[model samples]
Target: MNAVTNPHILVVDDDPDLRDLLATYLGANGFAVASAGDGAAMWVAFNERLPNAIVLDLMLPGEDGLSLTRALRAKSSVPILMLSARGEELDRVIGLEVGADDYLAKPFGPRELLARLRALLRRSHVLEAESAAAAAPPRFGPFALDTLGHRLLRGGQEVALTSADYELLVALVAHPNRVLSRDTLVDMLRGYERDPFDRSIDNRVTRLRRKIEPEPAAPVFIRTVRGEGYLFNPRGGQP
Candidate 1:
């Protein structure tokens, strides 16, 4: 998500009434609003212009909210507030696990939504400011990996990245062109305590590739070495 003076918020829900309510309320509260009926529409709106934050409902006609959340989080760090009609504990947990920044049950007030949106934007602003203040970020292709800022920039525009993604990127860029084993990467990631069956390193790699690679399917930057782990190529193309 790039910096904008008037924060844009995208609301994804099947309920036309709810969408109207939010558009009116958020617009009145000084926010630019976009509405999408489902995951397909959400993507169209997203690709057209990335929103500062997304309010995604849990249930949709196809590709439920959790799936959408995971897909979005894999590439972008846009703040997501998931809404579920069920209000089940499992649903909330799953939503957050899939990368929702916050969750709200159905029948929520517009004012509360506005408040949560503001909070997310506030946090995002602080992050942007920190990234802007950082000196001498490393360049790779069209990207500048801001180690101090804990973010990534492409052509001077901020590309949203999670802390875990940033850490993984830092490790990879620090040892460019070297294949680092998964175990080594797991150890390098600070505060990442793992289970015996944990494969978060691989997951993080996939997520990172989606953001940085021109073609994730045939990655040019981060290459997977058969039986060896992964290698980051700062210059891109074959290692």
Candidate 2:
């Protein structure tokens, strides 16, 4: 995908009116828009042609956003922005936990949604460029990260990771031996503005450490720098 070109977006919502509105608005803003009414349609659309990002609605007739998110996480790491009614913080958290990058409460304006989508797509492009620039795989501690394939290998064995986790690890490894603040990691990993008091970044780092660290409690690869932040020790040499 060209950096200047518009992105392809999949909007999944059971509400026909809202789905149409989103498609129209996104199309007007120069995005190639695709719409799906439910998870089955979402799967078909994804299989036929993968979108750059997904706008998923939490409430659906069948196979709700959370289920679809989990299902998608099992295969693809496409960026997902979840939609929910106001006061559904639990659903938002679950969506994030299941691998959705961001969420927006409903009754939102088209402009706001477009802005969020653009931010995410822009971040995705940046990450892609960074990965492309790294010709060889990078090794840090027990993990060997294939930048091109976006796969992680631990102790010479492949380990599964969510897109968000891989991006967070890349961001940390990019500035090896340097501390990355939680706020910075949140912004880079979430592909959007960081929210105050959001614990998602910490949770993702913890999960990643569990997969790559010999002891997640006393992580050597990703170390806490006290008042600073987390550091990715490149003791294993850069690949």
Candidate 3:
């Protein structure tokens, strides 16, 4: 792929050897790679050339990965994959909660890291395409979505949403009148499987329904499917 089309990834790690290794592997695997040693350098590289995804280290010289993640999330929805050392499950969870889409512990295999990176990049691209598709004045219930501009309107008033929430909404709305299982939704939104007990998808859907449905308690636009999952009922809703 051309440089413009190739997914650009920023690898930010204090370890030069690891950084170079990641850059080399990612570059060889159809991605354009940029490297930075610390948070300041990461910001510099970010300003110079915005990457499609960031592989950020949890431990940095000045600003740490979590801080950087919060900072970036405040402005942009660029995909972030955090890298932490072994035995840092707390850090991993915090990373996810703070808008980092994925995390990998150190001493990880190059292949596994590559797989995770590819999965994240693939999900990002899918979301972009879905956003473009949803922007074309599509209607469901009292809600109208402008996918291109990433805005939702309810009763002609705009409704705010986070990146994750918007993506889940698009996935459901795009396939209205169908039952989407929790696992399916997870795959659609997260680009991977989760543990059976992981409830992120359910939580996101609940939050989305509250915003879009006039009565979140008895959601009309998004309905539960019992043992199956959830469905968007657009038959009686505005088109």
In angstroms, the error of model 2 at 48 is 1.6
Prediction 3 TM-score vs. true: 0.61
Better of 2 and 3 by lDDT: 3
Model 1, range 127-230, lDDT digits (tens) per residue?
A: 55445546667678899877676679998789988888887887677667788888666645532234646788889999999999999999888999999899
The count of residue-pair clashes in candidate 1 stands at: 0
Greater TM-score among 2 and 3 belongs to: 3
RMSD of each: 14.9, 8.7, 7.4
CA lDDT of each prediction against the hidden true structure: 0.83, 0.81, 0.81
| Ranking of predictions according to lDDT | 1, 3, 2
Evaluate residue 229 in candidate 1 and report its C-alpha lDDT on the 0 to 100 scale.
Answer: 92
Q: Give the 10-residue window scoring lowest on summed lDDT in candidate 1.
A: 187-196
Using TM-score as the measure, which candidate wins?
Answer: 3
Q: After superposition, how far is residue 49 of candidate 1 from its true place, in Å?
A: 1.1
User: Which residue pairs in model 2 clash with each other?
Assistant: none
Candidate 1 residues lying further than 4 Å off, grouped into runs, are 1-4, 136-239
Quote each prediction's TM-score.
Answer: 0.56, 0.59, 0.61
Writing each residue's lDDT as its tens digit, candidate 2 over 1-239 gives: 24538788999998899989998888988999899999999988898888999999988887888888999999987888999885477877888999998899988988888878876776676577566646867776666787777788877777989887888877776767778788666655664566778978778889988887877888888888887778888783334
Candidate 3 clash pair list: 135-147
